[model samples]
Target: MTIAHILHRVADYDAWRKVYDSVGDMQKDGGVTQESVHRMVDDPDNLLVIHHFDTMESARAFFGRSDLRDAMERGGVQGEPRVELFE
Candidate 1:
């Protein structure tokens, strides 16, 4: 089944842009296929990241790794990201 991963952050556009740019190469190398990425117009600070994989297991395997977590932290992520998985 296909899975969906959602992320919500409370940082400004510049901050989020910096983090997104920093992770560009890593995300490509990590096997995450970006489906779509968008920011709410009403709330510029809110962002939604959507990615898809062959299975939930594959998604978890990639997301559960330490390198991604480290990259996120180093990218100045202030709070815990809300993650949701769905078919």
Candidate 2:
């Protein structure tokens, strides 16, 4: 099964841009073999990250990495960003 991550941000574009720029390299690195990312039209601040991993284990392994989590936090992301995991 594929794992999907839905992220919603309530911050301004400048904050989002800053965080996005800081994490640019990390995001380029593939977490899973098969992944697709999308931005929702309903909410410009919302981003949908879809991953089609070889297995749920692989997906979890990637998502559970502390390095990436640290990077995200260090990126200085502000506002209340909601995250939802779906399978």
Best by TM-score: 1
Q: Which stretches of candidate 1 lie over 4 Å from their true place?
A: none
Q: Which residue pairs overlap in candidate 2's backbone?
A: none
RMSD after CA superposition, every candidate: 2.2, 3.8
- After superposing candidate 2, which stretches have Cα over 4 Å from the reference? 10-31, 74-87
lDDT of each: 0.70, 0.55
lDDT of 1 by residue, 54-77 (tens): 677777776787887886676555
- For residue 42, model 1's alpha carbon misses the true position, in angstroms, by 1.7
Q: Could you give candidate 2's per-residue lDDT for residues 34-73 as a string of tens digits? A: 5554667877555655555555665666666677566556
In model 1, pairs of residues that clash are none
> How high is each candidate's TM-score?
0.74, 0.55
Query: Which 10-residue span in candidate 2 carries the lowest summed lDDT?
Result: 75-84
Error of 2 at 53 (Å): 0.6
